[model samples]
Target: MSRTTATIDPAELKAAGTARQTDSSAPNADRPRRRFNWGKVFAWAVMIALLIITVFPFYWMLRTSLTSNSALYANDMSLLPTDFDLGGFARVFGLQSPEEAIAQGGSGASIDFWRYLLNSVVVATAITVCQVFFSAMAAYAFSRLHWRGRDFVFSLFLLSLMVPLIYTLLPNFLLIRDLGLIDTLLGIMLPSLFMTPFAIFFLRQFFMNVPTEIEEAALIDGAGKIRIFFRLIIPMTVGPITTVAILTYMNAWNDYLWPLMVSYTDDSRVLTVALGNFTEQTPQTGPDWAGLMAATLVAALPMLLLFLFFARRIVNSIGFSGIK
Candidate 1:
């Protein structure tokens, strides 16, 4: 006997297909779209408020820099500049002669602005370069090299982070004095030139995250540890390297106490120290508030520009380094 097959009805098949489609689409048809979250709105409001609070001082400094001396000390607080004045800036840059500066209602002190600025640039650049390079080498050894007592050594190094900079300042000053580097840019940069614990820790975390296979392959290709580090590891970690450089540069640039302690003369003084001295010793007139604000703005400009330019890379590297 031959076996027979039964065929389905077209109408029944069509109805079943329609039912399945309706069932699949039911959730979409019945579900409501999400409305904007009020919690998010509140959170953003708080953030904006905090941002304004944090940035208000810089804004005030810039505003005061543009305000005339009379406008700056006027009873009424004007958030915006009433009369735009360049005398403060001129005084800061030594653009006006003492006689002319005094004639223009400015403190007649001649600040060697360019000299201090150059000193800052040289010291900050040297510190950033040396610190980043040395920290990177230390990080490579800690992350990749096998050695006895490495962990213990690294732990001891981390302990340095706990020691306050104030505690070391006197000893560091004595050492610099012994070297006869006082009143020199080299003295200002010497403390930071070697390596910072934070920099090594930051870089080592990134270095550890690098794939071991890359180093192994480099080794198989007859590349030594130093060659592998320079070629393979460094090339892969530009983000972290640049992040450390920016950070180190910012620190060295903004450093006030150390530079002030080491350098007193205009020839060797950095921008921060110069600005502080200028503020304190304005001519027979009271503190030159507008000129001081102008000088402060000029000194802070580089760090602001640096952060604005490299902020994204800095944030990414910090996140990648597994630091909170």
Candidate 2:
């Protein structure tokens, strides 16, 4: 029994020694095989930095809007609102500015904020509809359909784009006045925005990028130019078209200078002009920092939300489409 026990103890000791050796060797084996990757970590850091930079402005704006007027004026400007209040938003949503509208006519008479809202809606909608229709048709002509001097005409339009808006401002104003469209929504919207060259060009490039085989197949099936455009081309490029429409709607909605110049009457005003009206208020009457900022936020909120929602699709379209 002692002899058997001595043999068993040696075997156990040998096994334990082998196990220890295996265990110690395991980590050493992995050490040579393991690769330290900094590329992924660097890429992640870059993305996080970009995200912070991109979203910071919007976060600041939200915090500022929620902050009280006195708190906003604190010596230490902060990312956080010192005193959070919603009264600024409330004042902005108030339909009538008593100082401008009600006072101008008196208590019984009210200035029409609703009218300005309606005006913005009408002008933006009409311009969007017209611009889309016109731009699409023009793009189709330049892309799929052939006409005389098409390249030359397109180049001229491109050159026109380089001319600064300031250069044509006077001419456009004079033209609007001559047409007696001054103080009218039509006057404010017609001159430059009704049919934008940029929109046409953007749509045209996307249209060209479309599979020519599809268009050819439609043509062989006895489809006309208009039919091919509506059925095949339009469906394929819906992303870019959506981007264009949103841009057009935003431009018309936020138009400040032209609307202020052409439309004076409360009957035909838009939100931008109305917001500016808040800034012109004398502090002796009552400073409206809260109200003014609120109105600006309200005006910008829609566009910001729109871009946020559609950013993915817009980016996809631009990535897929090209200038050539």
Candidate 3:
């Protein structure tokens, strides 16, 4: 028996390995590399610049709030806080003595921050809840239920939106006065408590997109209209409902003109009116820039937190589709 032995060349093996590597990378080598996308880069740059511009004011406000009023004028242009002090917060809360406040360029008389904040909360909350609820009900009726003159009535509502808010203020004020609700929180909330035309329209659009089959199923199961609304429709449409509530709350919370017209005393004064009055009473020296900034931050904190908490919900709701 004879055995044959084969000897392989190292150069040939090396060449074969190199060929395999080349073959493996041939597709990638043939493919074109992506070029630098100047448009995308430019877009990102613009967005970053806009973000800085938008955020800088709030940062300045916070910096001023932390700065000392006496040194504020000197360091007005400084981007950072100067002579860090808590006296601004103290003045806002009435913790500083009149002499100290006056020395710090403050008004000496502290505004009732807590009381006005409470009044704002009450008014905003009442208006938001009531307006959203009534708006949803009205939207359902307009979108889901067919009735005589439904489109006509809805068009009338849309028309109301065109009317200037200022145009109706005098009439609203007179009505509130006649009801003897002037200088009351109820009066401040009454105008917006029912439903805004915008709110009704917004909800109606979403309601119309709801699937009829699901609603029909519920009806077959003997679910009444009210039951279906509260149990099924509301649950399914939580995203839009939350959006409506947030918008309504923001409008009510930021409403200054109506509250100013109705509320005269401390009992019904909202934060906006109180802030206006606070600035008006500035001393001969100047406005208490630090204290005023601090108060403004407090006034804006609620809305900031609200947006932060429900930001995802808002994003989701904006592109919501009712189809499963």
Candidate 4:
């Protein structure tokens, strides 16, 4: 008989709902605030310091190149070029006359900058091409092919990596001399043109990771080893190949000692060797700091650009190419 239910106000219900939502939205009083992390701050500070230390030298080189040779001694410690001039670059490219160069405190000796640049390009390109190709072939053989005494042969090849590069210079020089290739670009190219132990090892690591099932399928299809390598394995491993080529090219481009020992004249003299001679050309005073820095900056620009362009690829490929 008593079925009466108490009536509730919609307005009260709405207000209660609003209050609950407001309470829920409020910040938590019991939550702890984050404290400043000195460790992270210290790490960032250290990294910035190292960045400045590493980059200041290049900035100084740019400053020296921009400053006039006559004023370099006066403003030796200036952060910015006090006597700003582009004549150092002019001197580098042989645009300044001997009298003009000397008046500007240069050595007045021509750099043969174009000739040396050409020689460097030729030698480096030749070495990168030949070395990468041969090394990739050798790596394919070692990693993919089954043959008697393969591991032993690879071990012997790896042992060569332990040999000091300087120890072989005399022998290589003698061999080039006997071949009558001294003072020639061919002589410079011949030594590193075939392959390097490190190159083989690097490529072998990548080659070993290629799935064997794909190769077995190619074999079933009557594809030969050469065809399979060219068509299948190579296409699958472009990243490592590119990394290797970039590294090999940079090494060949920057090589100084071998080029210095083999070539004496402008015929095969590389930029590095030319720069060394350039330092001695102005013996009366000191090295033509302005012009020398300008030339050096020019010489190093290529590798810098190369690394900048392919840096991401190299970094990303190395992790995947390593022992798996």
Regions of model 4 farther than 4 Å from truth: 1-36, 283-286, 316-324
Index of the highest-TM-score prediction: 4
lDDT (tens digit, per residue) of candidate 3 on 152-245: 9988998997899999999999999999999999999998888998778778888888899999999999999989889878888887888989
Between which residue pairs do clashes occur in model 4? none
Which candidate, 1 or 2, has the higher lDDT?
A: 1
Error of 1 at 143 (Å): 1.0
Structural RMSD, model 4 = 12.2
Rank list by lDDT: 4, 3, 1, 2
**lDDT (Cα, 0-100) at 281 in candidate 2:** 51
Question: Top model by lDDT, which number?
Answer: 4
- What is the alpha-carbon lDDT of model 4 when measured against the actual structure? 0.86
TM-score-better candidate, 1 vs 4? 4
**Per-model lDDT:** 0.83, 0.72, 0.84, 0.86
Better of 3 and 4 by lDDT: 4
Which prediction has more favorable TM-score, 2 or 3? 3
* TM-score between candidate 3 and the true structure: 0.83
**TM-score of each prediction:** 0.83, 0.72, 0.83, 0.84
Q: Once model 1 is optimally superposed onto the true structure by TM-score, how far is the C-alpha of residue 5 displaced, in angstroms? A: 57
What does candidate 2 score on TM? 0.72
